[model samples]
Target: MRILIAEDDPSIAAGVSASLRQGGHAVDAVTDGAKADAALRDTPYDLLILDLGLPNLDGADVLQRLRKRGTGLPVLVITAREGLRERVRVLDLGADDYLVKPFALAEFEARVRALLRRYTSQGAPELTIGRLRLDLPGHRAWIDDKPLELTAREFGLLEALAARPDRVTSRAQLVEALCSWDEELTDNGLDIAIYRLRRKLADSGTQVRTIRGLGYLLEEVKEGKESEA
Candidate 1:
């Protein structure tokens, strides 16, 4: 999934972004609340990790504006403010979960998974597209019961394509799903990612097909056809 982190502290932001990337998520980060709010408005994200002590616009105001806009996006607030009233206020502002600073990475990740699972369709954590199986909480994908060796970006790519198996996933959609703002997706970079994914799934029952002008599609491999698109 794609996540946005709104934090001013570089250390904390880098650490959290690395952890989430290791778990197969595409993460973008902003150092101030204004940029955070702008990213939230422009990008499609599955979760938002917000810090309260933000410059320009505070995280609470960000949350307030978010809710006022009627966006139901799940938010997980991470902050140094440990007061009960602060927690209550943030929750009242529409944060799905809150984690105080000095939190265990394990616990933080668990909260992320829980929120994602809770909001997923029918609350189903596992996504099955033919022989390909995805465990969102576990951040793993398998084909024919065998785990597919995939990098974090590749996992994000697969998830994005699988999210719309019957329809074409546009290049912009894949870029949004797989690349953060810092890691821009050039045309060659996109082609390399797609080539790598196609190579890994070559022998699987499915294939990634290039759609010429549109983008790409994931479909079952037909009999008497080339495996790679």
Candidate 2:
């Protein structure tokens, strides 16, 4: 998952970034709301870990603007503002979850995972298409009771595909979801990732079908059957 951490405090930002990166997530940390907004506008993020105290536009304003433009990016407000009213206000402004400062890294990680799971599953943890099962929080994928060995990128791709089964995911979107800004995302890179994922998930009967003019779509490929498209 690609996460944007908008925090003014350097220590907090670095800590959050490192923790998230170690958790196998692509993180982009910004110290102010303006930079955060720019990042949001340019890239597609699965989650946003925002601090209320921002330098430029303020966290609330950034969120408000995003919502105003109909961008429903899931946001978790990580702030020191523990007051009841403050929490209520942020929630009202469309923050999906809130975590007070001085939190344990484990708890914070759990919260982020939970929020992403909810966001992707639309409030459900288990996403199933045919016999394939995806446990979002557990970061596990199963097919017919057998677990598949998938790299983080492959797992991310599968997760994204499972979120909208049978929906075509453009190469660009898949690249964004699976790679960080620093990674070289080429057409061949996506192809290679898909190839590896397909091989590992052979038994699952899930195939990454390439649409001639569009992109790739994940669907159940019957045993001994192939996609004509």
Candidate 3:
């Protein structure tokens, strides 16, 4: 998943970003609400970790604007406010969930997982494509019950492809999925990752097909011949 963390505190932002990345998510961190809003507008993120007390535009206002746009992007607000009214106000303004400051990392991650599950896959943690099985939570992939040693980027690429098996996933979308603002993936980089991923999945009864000028597709391996599509 690609996530944007809008937080002013460097320590908290770094910690949360690290944890999420460790969980196989691409994350971008911003220190102010204006930058956060800009990033939100420019990028397509699976989730947003927003801090209510922001510099230029407050978190509540940000949430309100996002909702006003009818985006329906799942937003998890983080605030130091413990008042019930404040919580309700943000919820009313379209914050999907809230977490008070000084919270446990485990709990924070759990909340993130819950939100993602609810919004992305209806609580399902595994995605299967023929003999290929991707354990979303565990960040692992397997073929015929044997595990494939995939790098983080490789796993992310596989997940993106497997999300819509046999459908064309454009290079732009794949680059977005594998990169954050801090890390940029060039066309060559994406190609290398795809090549490595294909090699790993060669015998897994699945194939990553390049669609010439289009993009890539994950499909069931043909028995005797390759597919031109």
User: What tens-digit string does per-residue lDDT give for candidate 1 at 1-229?
Assistant: 8899999999999989999988888889999999998988888788899999999999999999989989899999999999999999999999999999989988998899899888765578887765777776667888878998898778888888877858999998998888777788888888899999988887777888888899999888767777764
27-73: candidate 2 lDDT, tens digit per residue: 77888999988988988788999998898889999989888879888
How much is 199 displaced in model 3, in angstroms?
Answer: 2.2
Error (Å) of candidate 1 at residue 218 is 1.5
Q: RMSDs, each prediction?
A: 2.0, 2.6, 2.4
Per-model lDDT:
0.87, 0.81, 0.86
- Give the range where candidate 1 is weakest over 10 consecutive residues by summed lDDT: 129-138
Candidate 1 vs candidate 2: which has greater lDDT? 1
Question: Which residue pairs come into collision in candidate 3?
Answer: none
- What digit string (tens of lDDT, one per residue) describes model 3 on residues 1-229? 8999999989999999999988879999998989988888888888999999999999888888888888988999998989999898889899999999999999999899888777764557777776888776457789988998998899999888877765899999898898877888988999889888888887777889888898989888768856332
List the candidate 1 regions with Cα displacement exceeding 4 Å.
222-228
Give lDDT for model 3.
0.86
Give the Å error, residue 85, model 3: 2.4
Q: What is the lDDT of residue 203 in candidate 3?
A: 71
Compare candidates 1 and 3 on TM-score and give the better one.
Answer: 1
lDDT of candidate model 2 versus the reference: 0.81
